[model samples]
Target: MAVLSKQVAVPKSGFSPIPVIDMSDPESKHALVKACEDFGFFKVINHGISAELVSVLEHETVEFFSLPKSEKTLVAGYPFGYGNSKIGRNGDVGWVEYLLMNANLDSGSGPLFPSLLKSPGTFRNALEEYTISVRKMTCDVLEMIIDGLGIKPRNTLSKLVSDQNTDSILRLNHYPPCPLINKKTNCGKNVIGFGEHTDPQIISVLRSNNTSGLQINLTDGSWVSVPPDHSSFFFNVGDSLQVRLIS
Candidate 1:
């Protein structure tokens, strides 16, 4: 759900400070290429998904996470349904809980929704609508990326990523507020909402509530905060995509 990258400098000659691109612009293709090559991540605006839909999705997400723990546990299955940090055997734990669903149902071999959610028309409808919209946007961006890379036959990348049998997993993450912060107690133990790690998918699109916890490492070995903007989505080029592009 979150993508973290290690230090890799933007070459001095063509560095873009913000790495945001308006997909509607005529020159966005060139900008996309530069963003991928220089930063490996970028923010996208004018992506055709309605703001109202995004708001609805955010609200529904909060509602889902607000459900009673027992209710959520009905779908508690590793890598497929709802899960908490405790699911992992390692002693280390994070302050996050998540729900995972396949964005494209046709591509998924198993049931699209956990049994508890299947009967709720409202929840299912909202999630399905949001997933469809996101899938379209993701495909659109992938096409642009391929074009920007000058891949002969624009559909090459599209076909590779859009296989009807491959499901794109959508992970809804909720990072709970740390109680220790309010007490101001020095527990001497670090609390991480989500650990730092790179995404392994071809690409990852992330939208977060307007709180600034996301950080990416810089070439100078320092971490830089990525300011949260509720109005846009952050796009991360995953290792697979980078490999495909370069090869």
Candidate 2:
């Protein structure tokens, strides 16, 4: 029902860190896989996305949401009508709102997005700039994860992307502050942040606003916030990938 699937968060190993893939040396791959198998999540550095690009995207995001809801809704909505509407409808709203912009020109199709985001044919110049950069970054990470797994000839990554209906709609999420929520976790979810939902998308390069909220579940039952790392995209194994590991 949700674009993101729910996962029980109350476990014991809480917030384990994935091996930061160095990619600089031969040892990086083994470390990367070990981390993924152990925690299923990790923070990435040396990802090709430039700091300037992240800044611009962040800026544009803030600008987009700054508009009133009427203007915002034009972009898009979540699968079960979650992303753009008022919160309580989607677990108290998470104090955030967003839009999805797929980077692929022909790969992802829509009405998944609106005129501004899906303006691929009309090219808004500014949006195009952002699109190109995000797309490049998405592709780069896909390669590393595939390579890191040490699987070959099978091209599992390619299959994953193609199968997921690989869509890169940039989500512009807005988390409004609830007086109670503010106090509970700095306007964050008492550290519970957006619950523990595995992205339905093959890869969600979440580039969120400076505001809080957003944490991952650990086996130990502790939900840890993957603090906002400026200009960096954090990658985690989503539900499909996790299931693939299951069998």
Candidate 3:
């Protein structure tokens, strides 16, 4: 819960100047490599997903999370369904709830909406479509990363991590506004919406609503806030990717 003093500057204009890459551009390959090498994260634009679909996905997500806690518990399962704590069994808990599910394109599986919501609506269908789109984009970015590292896409690194059967999880996180924003806990730390932690996957592609709270820890021991711009997706290289890069 230690705070850092230096903050990364966020652009407030036409587009973010913070390593925003257009995936459709061929020149973006070099930028992708540089962003990963320097910060291990970057924002991507011109990703093939449509804005309408994005809106649909976001609306459905908000609806799903807005359900009563008792209703949400129906689809709850370990590490794969609805969850509210960042650190399980720990005294401190983040003000976040998430629905986790496997996002394998071949399986056509989507987020676990309640059975009550299985009627003729766009919620389930939109989620399925969005999951497939995001999965494809994830694979595309992984392939680009492999190419950046001068490794063949068909090589072991790419094949193992990018395999359709691999344990690729899609997490929809909702960080509710903390009620005790001005108050501190016994540990002298403010209530965390989402605790600082690294992801366990090879990489994570995150899209957020314009509520900016994401931060990245720089190598020089400084933390930088990543202001949300709903137009782009944030790509984060995870622990596995770090290990691969270093080794």
Candidate 4:
């Protein structure tokens, strides 16, 4: 969890002025809408997801990643299981590895790597609990957005995600540090972890370790580094939501 400095252009203010919304506050609804309209991104606090649950899930995830590559590859596949470096069917690649799982899977569906890990049960249990908690928080946030917009039927947006058949995904990304290549020639820059991209879902909820390297493109065409807050969740308004707002 060491802090790694990023070699990219930063906001002139030297800080990310991303909007912070407190879920417990009744007046936060309007602010949430404003954040979506302005930056399409914001940080949420006062979310009820417990620190203990987050810690447990993070520990299990790290343990899984620490396993030898051969063992980790047991669950390797595209669109649903473990993936390393390669992103999507395209030739895109990044300096990261990830595990993508279907969030709607039944709790008793069993572990993704039951025979590969010493504590497979623990990993599966942690994943289920974490997904359930995060899904709840996502619904709450969506409801707030609906309220802020004065949309008919408060559940308009929330229902899309809360439904049993919802096509939701949980991605765990690990960006391991790489040695700098030819410092002077490379301008002392680290390889891009994941290239610039927009989420195609209605919304995306993201949380990461204390290390900071994330950046968001602003409406005015400037990019600002997102300050890391491992305890708080960040929400991104995706393409579907943006189109829905206009239509």
lDDT of each: 0.71, 0.53, 0.70, 0.80
Highest lDDT: give the candidate number: 4
* Residue 226 Cα positional deviation in candidate 4, in Å, after optimal superposition: 0.4
Q: Write the per-residue lDDT of candidate 3 for residues 1-247, one digit (tens) a residue.
A: 2222222344343232457888898667777877766667788888998889999878778888778889887877765777876544453468888887776634645435646454426876776688778777776777777777777633445465456687777778887756656444545356667777777667778888998777776545655678888888988877777777667
State the lDDT of candidate 2 residue by residue for 184-225, as single tens digits. Answer: 455544533244455655555555445555576555445666
Ten-residue region with minimum lDDT total, candidate 3:
1-10
TM-score of every candidate = 0.84, 0.69, 0.82, 0.89
List candidate 3 stretches off by more than 4 Å: 1-17, 86-92, 105-112, 118-121, 154-162, 182-189
Candidate 2 residue-wise lDDT at 212: 50
Q: Which residues of candidate 1, in runs, are more than 4 Å off?
A: 1-16, 86-92, 106-119, 186-189
User: C-alpha displacement of 10 in model 2, angstroms?
Assistant: 13
Residues 1-247, candidate 4: write the lDDT tens digits.
1111122344666565778999999799999888877667889999999999999889888988888888878888767778888889985777788888778757332236655777878888888888889999999999998999998898998888888877888889998766654666885385778877878888999897898888886544566788889999999888888777656
Off by over 4 Å in 4: 1-14, 107-111, 180-190
Candidate scoring better on lDDT of 1 and 4: 4
Top-scoring candidate (TM-score): 4
Model 1: per-residue lDDT, tens digit, 1-247? 2333432565554333658888888568888877776667889999888888778777777877777889887877755778787534553467889887766654453333435543466666677787778777777788887778777777665564466655578788898766755445666247777776667778888887798877765555445678889989998878877677556
Every model: Cα RMSD to truth = 3.8, 5.6, 5.0, 4.9
